[model samples]
Target: MDTALIVTVVVALTAWVFLLRSSMISMIWGPVVRSAGGDAVWAAVTSVVLYIAGLAAFALVVLAVHWALGGLPARALVLVLSALYAPVAFMPAPDRGARPYEDVRRALVRAGATEEQARACAWATGPLAFAGLAVVGGAVISVFAG
Candidate 1:
């Protein structure tokens, strides 16, 4: 196999593993502590499986792009990936009322947060999420650029 293809596979696999591990940890620990509920072991196992499936889907998409483009254009690929994930950053804003964090906050406070507080928190988190996506995109681009 070509060095680039080998490198791509390795990078994808590493990303998949990292995501799976983190997802598993969060799923197991977060819910267990947050609500004092759910089965941590099952959560961990299920999250790992789901994350692996997500990685498979991501790999397919990347492969499709690579094939269609006839080679990786690192900058373009990074831009496309960033655009695809950009929605995630904005998603928390519109539905904060229904989100788990808001639910927890409301449970603690008699009247919950004012609309402004909720909006501020949601908007603040969006930028952090975008920064995280950018970091991931940069890592991906660097791998393929090799």
Candidate 2:
């Protein structure tokens, strides 16, 4: 119930989501957005809605975790959460030619990107990217809060 703890949880959760989920939205939903084609307004609106909804859902989860770890210090909670999520982020990257990656690349190509550009973009979406963002973000938040 401490104001400082509340503020730290909110700040750390917001930063974590911005660092992680926002990128995921673009990567996972980019194809759908591009498929809107000439309807730029529709695409933009849908993207905005998705982002808002995703943020809300993610925030709820963070709040639940915060409540569950109420007895823990903010910095330790942050580190524990980060460590728990690290396994997910550290999962081996799928092969570039794997079905999901190929599907994403193909979608991008169909959406008008060149093969090379699509390939690079698809590669960038690998979960491995989450490792650095999560660890660095958690450490930074913990330091600032502590």
Candidate 3:
């Protein structure tokens, strides 16, 4: 199996999970944090841009490491990080955003926002669930590829 593929798969998946978590946080509290004049649309656009930038940075560093040292060490770092991430990725996503805000969101739920709407109110969004499958699929592909 090619190490580029392994690195690419793992790095991108890690990046995406991080992006999803950030996006969820934004959706959950973009309004409160920037209440006076926050644009959700713009906030989302910014998050995607940041994710792309970070992913590019990660790819460059990992690929450079692969070229300078060797593939095994580069892949090993990602593999270990993913192992540490397994508990978070495997566990159920928390019902609301991260804490402090979770309390506010809970209050919103009590104040009459619908279950789905209170937590996930947004103008536009990405398909995070299907996107998660891409990560899973990448892992499955890597397995079969070897």
Candidate 4:
């Protein structure tokens, strides 16, 4: 509600959106686009628009959580969410044959990365990276928010 908190939320959400978009493009869509001989510019533009929309929706959720929790510090909320996500995010993919996993791996491989590299990239750019960002960002925000 205060100026400091508003500032913090804006900065945090912006960073989150940036990281998400970058990972999505580089590790996911970029490969697909390249393999399909699509226009990178158009893909980038569409991705940015979609990501910004997602950012707006996520911002509303963050605000709603802040209010619903009776002014719980956003930093604390972030930390809690990150903690909850860690197990699920870090867990090995249950099935390599799953559509999403196979598609991502295939894309990366088609983009000229080796099988091992594709696997690593898929894991890195997926939930693991986002959850890690949340944890680290939350910790840093806590230090300053406190």
Candidate 5:
């Protein structure tokens, strides 16, 4: 297999793992955190749901772009889309009374996590969700480079 293809596959796998982790955290832990009276478990759950939904959306977009472009161009299109979607992983929780990340943080703190620990946890999980796109982008570039 081409190195580019390998890179692409790796990235996609990474992204999938991140998405799965996020979903699992929300589904399994969301309720526990909420029951504990953490800030806004619902909001955090909503964000996780949204994040998963966004990944689905990106997948559809990739399929559509592939269909439209065909072959190499499809890869290019995927790269562009991935690049565009990458930043969303880092989005802060909703403010204006919307508390998703904050809710999670509150729960973590209640669970004896320090502020730094909670933030670090958020940073770790949040970015993993975007790893797939990053892989796609890397794969596209690698393929095109050859």
Candidate 6:
């Protein structure tokens, strides 16, 4: 219903998907490929379904923010949304590994994650790192916001 909310949601969602693309695409693609014995059609269907689900969740987050905050002015709403997502969109260290931290990665390898599975878990770092940063950022903002 609100234009700014709409824009912010669309942009933030786009950024999230872009940020998640490489690894997650691999993740979704892997299963269907295996289960259907490398069926391109099944892989495509699975990918589409998963993507739509992710987008829906992003929409829900925006709606929740709107309802919880009562109605931020468009500018302010956009600012808050940016604050929430920017850290995720632009990670501080591009070269740094995304997840399973160094120790975790080693442990995963030791535990028998198959090279591919271990790599996938390592990619989990991308989302995990961003989610961690977002939570911390939100906490900092909350302290200042109040």
RMSD of each: 13.3, 11.0, 9.3, 11.9, 11.1, 11.6
In terms of lDDT, model 5 sits at 0.52
TM-score of each: 0.33, 0.37, 0.39, 0.35, 0.43, 0.34
Candidate achieving the largest lDDT: 5
lDDT agreement with native, every candidate: 0.42, 0.49, 0.43, 0.47, 0.52, 0.44
Q: Candidate 5, residues 1-146: lDDT per residue as tens digits?
A: 47777677557744654455344444443443445343454434544566666666776777677677778788766766655555454342222335446644654555544555455445444554455445445544543554
Q: Best by TM-score, which number?
A: 5
Q: After superposition, how far is residue 46 of candidate 3 from its true place, in Å?
A: 0.6
Best-first order by TM-score: 5, 3, 2, 4, 6, 1
Candidate 4's displacement at residue 91, Å, is: 21
Candidate 6 local lDDT, 113-141, one digit each (tens): 34454344444433444543454344324
Q: How much is the lDDT of residue 42 in candidate 4?
A: 44
- Kindly indicate the candidate among 1 and 2 with the higher TM-score: 2
Cα misplacement distance, residue 88 of candidate 6 (Å): 11
Worst 10 residues of 5 by lDDT: 88-97
Candidate 1: clashing pairs of residues: none
Taking the tens digit of each residue's C-alpha lDDT, what string does model 2 give over 35-124? 556454555455445534544454454556556654356446545656444332322223456475665456555655555555555455
Please give, for residues 1-146, the per-residue lDDT of candidate 1 as tens digits: 37877476546644554445333323332342333233334433443344344444555565566566644474467446644443332222132455644532232222233343433333433334344444445545543564
Who is ahead in lDDT, 2 or 6?
A: 2
Error of 5 at 91 (Å): 5.2
Number of backbone collisions per candidate, in order?
A: 0, 0, 0, 0, 2, 2
